[model samples]
Target: MNPFDNILDDEEIQELRKNHNHLRIKFNVLSIFTIIFIFSGMVLFKREKFPTYLEDLLNQPPNRLLHNINQSNRSNYSNVENFQNSLVSNLNGGKGTIQLHSQNDYWRESPLFDALKSGIISIETDCWYLDGQDYELFIGHYKYQLTNYKTLNSLYLGNLNKILDDVNSYNYKNSIEGEEKKGVFNDDPTQTLYLTIDIKNNPELTFKTLQQNLEIFQLKNYLTYYNTTSNEWFKGPITIIISGENIPYDSIKNLTIRNTFIDSPLYEILDISNQSNHSEFELKYSNQLSIFASSSLEKLIDYRSSSLSNYDFVKYGLNDEQIQKLKQYISKAHELGLKVRIWDTSINYDSLYNSLKTNIGINNKGNNNNNIIWNQLKELEVDLLNVDNNVDLLNNDAMIAAIGVSNNNNNNNIKYHDIEDNYNDINSNNSLS
Candidate 1:
């Protein structure tokens, strides 16, 4: 259509057309490539360009898997579930704190009454509305205890809001936090409190009431409910409880339930076994399990005690062959998604400084394998490590030889299940020098 079009020769016109066609093809290809590059850049680089909260998700414990007293999935039972459209934890992992018990064993057929008696601030129970008028929430009997209230009744069964109000109204208490001293003269408040509820059927409406109560109470955060063969009170809180310790689940984030024999595995075994014997013991608490104990190297040092020698780990527990096994244990722990802490059993008996006294080192002679341990700790981002040298931690005899921290839970404190067991359980609560 241009003025030059008619005047141009056929050869020039054809050549121009050919050049335009080639340019057109090149332009199309370049456009496609540019679009793809933009898209790929967004997915590959720009996606992570924003400050993603990867640590907040990764560092926290799982909620559905096994939530403790402080954590409950807000999304799953949210007053505002849809507000946070994210993954599991990010969606529902924030609750303030629910003051409840976590005794590992013994619960009633109807755990509801346990909640009422302040025997347990929170509990898990099965609801069976077998009766036409009511559904019984079974506690210790393994059979539904009939109740007159409907499932929707706030008194018998209700939302978390009411459950919490009830807990506060009842003046339920958390007994243990810090215990610097233990004896017949001292007292232990973190004992298992038990109460029985007989809900005679009428469960349909009553179960609703119970659920309402749970939600009202926000027992999800402070209380843990578990099913049991009978309705009885059991030990609550799997983690350590110290006297005067006010550590709430809301404040403390990094928590762990260590297994027995890692260092003091025998103690755990004994405690669990003893709990099983009691008819009132309830085993349905949180499902998280892993053992935190002294390393084999520390265990060997414990055995040698005053007679420990250099390279004892190689001779007793840490040879090249065994060292590989240690790495395997570490790897397995990681696979299980457990946060591991190194138990410095040897620190309780001797000092790391003493071990390095005679070691041959670098040109400076002061640097050696001990430094390697420190480097490993820094490199591994260890949660805890210990030194036996009391002086190394700045306190000689005043502090418990723990991971150089003043956490109250580190102090030994004993708790009892019944008032009568008070005297017998005192010594078990004593802290070691």
Candidate 2:
């Protein structure tokens, strides 16, 4: 050790120590600056809005988020009530001129709740019954989309039963003389929620299974039912309408009392009433048998054979002839005391793009072709406007103005124009063929 110590001078050793300390200080300063820069960069990035993906993830509706939470915890009834409360709070107390019908609510719980939050009164679910499935009815637009959890009871019937139970119990507990049974909407208690079930397979078998699934609601008397004994319809919080091709009318017809009703074909109402050679099921169609008369817009207007497609209705708007035809079908339904719902009114992305490209110089804020067709439908006095994207339409203020209704209207009653006078005025100029 002494031999090594003698190899270098004391001054040289002190100089080496000073240089090492200086290097250590510089490294420490660099590290502090590096950390500060990274933190500052993170702060700046966060100050701006989240990236699109993150934003979307965070912006999911509370009900949907709760649904996921509920999936993991099956026994959480409070989550369902939370979902219901969130939906009820977002409802516009009164309905607009035309009630909105959700086209694909069967996809999931989110869409159904989304439509309800957007003030939609009519909800549709596509149900299929297979020979060997555990559930009586599975809900989906296609067979491949079905899941064990998406049964008729799980997605719709059971949820509705719970909602009605909670709503009625709360109303009865708080009000004097047990307030007349209320509906899902706290703002509009008398408003009846229309639940349209589109049977996709085995109409007879599927409908029978659906009846079994509805026993709970039937027992609770929460469904609007026709009593053959009294020859009258007793209004309730919910109305069940069966729709789809080859609907087994015989199953529901001739019942002493039934909570389920049919969705009569809108285009053939006049034919069924006037023709003698029609089927017995067709002949029995009446206000007592059905609540809603529905058909595709193309079918009602006889536009299937035309060069133009159903999407063209959004682009070119309805001609005078088409308008007259729609009016006739709508008037016929009204005369029979049935509400009319026109579907297949969605615009494809290509059509929307083309429309925007063509209307470059015009004021097209809310005057898109879709809005034009919506206005036309409302003017035609169609009761329920079947919409594919109700959330987008209801959220757009300018579109709401174009449709001529304030979503903020808190009136207890929905104001609908008298169809007779409105129909007469439109037909005064040209006769309905």
Candidate 3:
């Protein structure tokens, strides 16, 4: 159609072509300069480690990072759910080494199974002993949440027995010299699975029901036991620890051999005035009969201030006041061969919501900010993080870095879970039990 020819004369067209060529040359020069600048920067920083930047990129907050990832890949999150189901299936079949605080919360469609698949070693189950209808014991955080199908036998013990059987079968087929029969966990054969039975109903009745149910696994030697005469402990595949109200030492004092251990009151035990009834028991069996000495984390750490920094005497870390208290509490427990576990530490919103929605109110005694609290606990070297988020705690980059593990779940060494020791002379005179 020659529309440009009709609009412009030959002299004007020549001028247009020259102008276009000049612009093209200028653009090419700018592009070449930009490339040179980038190359120079690489050469200048060649001595520096590039992997450090990559690590920094990966170590973002789990919630924020997961949010951004989900926002960007809406379809990918859907795929992740599908992948999670497959992951659970695979874990049920195979072995994994992840530490978990499966503390009576639902993570996936399957709570306990998902927790085990992810290598959660610690599981907390709240038990309520029913009075009628053949004396059934139920498992739930509240009366409303309890269901006939969700009994401790149905949800926890039955599944646990299956896991033990599977692990034993795997070990028999693939036995290694010097390697004893491992627990459900494949990575660490000596890892002891902690089944914390927190009683919510009549403590004596609930515990009695629990002990009766435990007899199912007792024949298989799947529970830890203490011999009073020999002062020897046979750590089994599963260690049953009891917590909650009415944990009177007088209840189980007469037994020559005990399978279950008690959760000691770290705070109350320090005060001699509160030792009216427990004085003899505390002196005699506090060291041997208890594995974890727990108190409220809020009581330990001051979280009133907005700023979590400032290593002042009143705020964070081992301030003078805290140092005295912790030494009185933690040091005594450690001296008595017990590890410290602080409960009621703040958990994330997702977990909190899940708890509240299910009529299971969180302790909610600590600060809303959990990251700072977690950091402080790690710095204090407190054992057994009483958290609700199984996935976040295990996957959090800051948590992994702070704990000095690339993956916190990979280390399944749980011989450190229970303290192995003989009662020292500190309580030698009070061995009346």
Candidate 4:
């Protein structure tokens, strides 16, 4: 070390050390830049691939994000204005009628509101009147399911009254002098929304309670009623239909004028004209007393047969004989000036048998059975298509195809009958019926 120090000058040694330090600093800076460049390249590659990956992910079934997006796109009306706009735009000029059934667990107020928003024309609610309660009708499928807050007045009638008040008041304020008052729908104000009430217990007491509850609507002139004095039935925004066994026909049948109408038994339509063949209940039904004739689909058609499989029924729909029987029932009801509504058509035999075997009540998840039944019913010209679950009806592709009109279309002049014709045309080549 001493010999090297002597041979080299101090300045030369210092210069050598400075050059080495500069090279070391340059290498460190280059290393950092190389790392940043690699990271940026990775980010760019991911960005390019992400969209396709996301699309693939969305295409997969049961994807929550995709489901949410579809739901929003299907039914995005979150307010009154949006709902009204959607209703007018999607309306098929009263050609087809859809009735929302209150069979699901979520039947309190939200389902009613959702149905209205979806532009459904008819709605059904099951009611029970408590012995101790005063003019209060509770809504639930069973006695054990009833809650104190969910009442016919609070949930349905009160809300309906309020909606009518707002709509009618606004309409009156912008009146055209002597024109008759309009109903809920802006496009077709005269179209009355049917409200079906299925009484669960005590027909007399429940009927009385329902009548008392409807006083507000009656006062507001928002209810459909028949005027015996004028021998005419006046159309209003809402029509109330009562359905149940042991109905107090005596109470309302004799009344000179009344708002509430009865739901006649469809099975007894064949014997209605023949007084000798008519039962006590069948004798009470008339064009004045009832507006809708209804029965379970099974009562009209023999869908349950050991020889035929459930899958075949779901695929092929009603056979020739069944169709004839159904046609006769519908024709008779129509002849009597009563609309026909068939219920218990959404049955999934496979699911039902499985449920029976399992002893666990699970909801039918697939709508193939419902879709097939609805198509046949539509082809048959059922006035009100009773649907148990309408959550995805407005947005379902199959339903839209069945309707033959898009809900998003801006064309306001498309009549429902035209849509029906279009549907018939589309299915003419290969119809389930």
Candidate 5:
């Protein structure tokens, strides 16, 4: 070691030390800037104001869609009637609209995809054909790169012939009159599901494989079919999907769905209402289910003023009595065999949950609009829950989700079941962010 050091030039050694020091200093400075840039991007939108939230947006109605997923003010969606007609009628034409999300939203990374398993009425997941494997389980269409939390595989490959296996399975038992269950991954008819798989691996192979799988169930014109192969969207029997190229990578909804399932490999639309598309077992379980409503019509359907320029949905302020009126629509949707739910009309969190879970009268929560939203949803006895939205969705805290449902709903008394029973597993992650 002494001989080698003597051979090295003094000037060279000095140069080496100076270069090393400079690099170290530069690296430290860069690290600080990188962190700041990342966090700054989180709260700000389009390099401007903070991202809009459902609550704040609910409080403030816009005159028109300030923003949309695809092109702005799409002539295709220039009017509200045109949009509704596209979804409810002319099902053969037009792509379905998906609400993009932001990373800051609490639901962006929770277990929404998995949580959907228990009482899901409708499920939509995009597919990617990148992997050549015979099957995929927990990957999303979006490619993950340069994540702060982890490293991702750095290649893009794809496959063909993705099947919603266990799509139709039979379960038999001896209970109060044993019954057989059907559908992919469900053991009970009362637990059927409408699974929307977005396929995009091998375009040509997707349809053939999906059709082949449909035969496995021998569906009775009720539970079969998917447009998972194509990126077309429709509200009818044949619609497949909307393009993925335009999605805001940071959207809350996108992150939630992405973390939940595997990327699809084909293309085609899946409509749960299409009885011919599924078997009886699937129809019974997934076809008709419940959903909640917001206090105001605008909030209930997410019909922003910009989205529905013709109707001044915001001009008519929502009140306690008016919130109850929303039940009329819920009942109407129910008549079509859908469940009804009400949420987000007010700020009294605890009282609303207690009343709904136990049928007890609310004491702490006042005669506010949220109370009415809770009462309306509970009285309807909705089978599903679209619960409270926490601004800090990244935390995925059950304390936020179960803010009020635990205390009890009836008898002005808190019951044990409210906390112990009728709630989703807290350990499981959520994507409500």
Candidate 6:
């Protein structure tokens, strides 16, 4: 017989069967009730329009979510693979002709990789220093939106380092004459990636943190620097130009050999030029300290109206008076061997600029006065055109055709510099927002 088969009698067996059936019925009823409760809760939640508490429970803020995603092991490999593929694709393509400024609105995309892949060498970030229990540097347009995931190292420095290494490896293998390594733009290997770091907080702390973090690149000799003693510039693949927050001049000046440069006040330089006393005047600015002399484009034009028009163009665009002032500034800066770049200008394809075009008159093909401003700047031979919609601004057929054409004076071989204006800094209030 089977071991212990006769443990229960027929009546006992019947009682046991009844108990099991009753328990199963209770479980089924409980499960159905649970399902109904969940369904009802979801409907109620949706109808209520997502309350604060509900939002906290149901959804996480994008930055926080991104932080978690970055920390997680699941997508690490995929992200790396994607980045590698993007780098390879970028390397294979012709470097974009324009200096594409990926504005604050486009930060949601992979900031560094996306812009680089698009062949945009220059990028700006509104940097904030976050010092708390967990000390970190964060980048965000506003203070409230700061997140740990989208940091300087994560978004820029690390990716830059990787790109540099990859490019160096490629150059080494290719072994071209005087091409040991290249920058993000392989076609123009000597072109420096202009990284404008606009400090929105404690300049000393933030910049110190930046310098400490960038030590790896510095060690690799991958940063542009000026040897003050030798009076020579060693232009590397990447140049970090610090702007905003008055930018501690002494801090920058104290450094013997430094890659970090400041954006000199171009408008102020104009005032300093018209000084009544030349004998008592002392040079307050030096090109050794700053590579670029930049200023507000609106201020430069004497912002009479809220629109960029032909009137504005003629009055301000390379006129005798404006050109004289511009020439003075350019001459002084060029004497110092510094390039001039005017900011707060028109960025084609930007809606803000387009909206201002109502009074300015758009072309039959929907082109705005951007071309006029661009051509005028080219005629003036502005070293850098700070503009938006870089892809279009660079490849605009009209602008390209106008490049080799003669100006009013019939000067052949007109030149164009990379456009580096970030439109996010432009505000509705007509200031640096």
Worst 10 residues of 4 by lDDT: 424-433
For model 5 the TM-score comes to 0.29
Candidate 1: TM-score?
Answer: 0.24
Per-residue lDDT for 132-161 in model 6, tens only? 713457888889988656677766786677
Give stretches of model 6 more than 4 Å off.
1-92, 99-108, 133-135, 170-180, 273-284, 305-320, 347-370, 391-433
Error of 3 at 94 (Å): 9.8
What is candidate 3's lDDT per residue for 35-64, written digit by digit as tens? 999998875464132211211223444343
- lDDT, residue 216, model 5: 24
The 10-residue segment with the lowest total lDDT in model 2 = 48-57
**Candidate 2 global lDDT:** 0.64
Clash totals for all candidate models:
97, 0, 2, 1, 72, 0
- The per-model lDDT (C-alpha) reads 0.30, 0.64, 0.56, 0.60, 0.29, 0.57
Off by over 4 Å in 3: 1-100, 105-109, 133-135, 170-181, 273-285, 301-320, 347-372, 396-399, 402-433
The order by descending lDDT is 2, 4, 6, 3, 1, 5
After superposition, candidate 1 runs with Cα above 4 Å error: 1-238, 241-287, 291-322, 344-349, 354-370, 377-383, 386-433
lDDT of 2 by residue, 1-433 (tens): 5778788799999999999999999999999999999998875564233221211223554345223343334334453364344324334434432367888775423545565555567899898998886346988888898867667776667656655654454322333421235666755666678999898989888887888777666666677777766565556678898998857888888677768888988988877777676565343456667878899887887776655454365456787888888899888887766778888753453453344335422243544333566668877778886766566656665555444444665533343333331323322321111
Ranking by TM-score: 2, 4, 6, 3, 5, 1
| Alpha-carbon lDDT of model 1 | 0.30
TM-score for each of the candidates: 0.24, 0.68, 0.60, 0.64, 0.29, 0.62
Show model 5 residue runs off by greater than 4 Å.
Answer: 1-124, 128-179, 182-190, 193-303, 306-325, 340-375, 380-383, 387-433
- Estimate, for each residue in 1-433, the C-alpha lDDT of model 1 and write its tens digit: 6886779799998999999999999999999999999998865552233212222223443342223223233224442222122222222123111122222112322223322222222222333435343323333223434333323232233322332322222222522222111100011223222211223344235434333443422222333222122221123221221111121222111222111111122112324435755421111111222212223335422344554445444113334543453454444443333323444433323444443343323223222343334334324433334332323332222221212222133332221111133322422431110
Q: Cα RMSDs of all predictions?
A: 24.7, 12.8, 20.4, 17.8, 20.3, 12.4
* Global fold similarity of model 6 (TM-score): 0.62
Which stretches of candidate 2 lie above 4 Å from their native place?
1-87, 90-98, 170-180, 278-284, 307-312, 346-370, 410-433
Cα lDDT, model 2, residue 370: 33
What are the clashing pairs of model 2? none
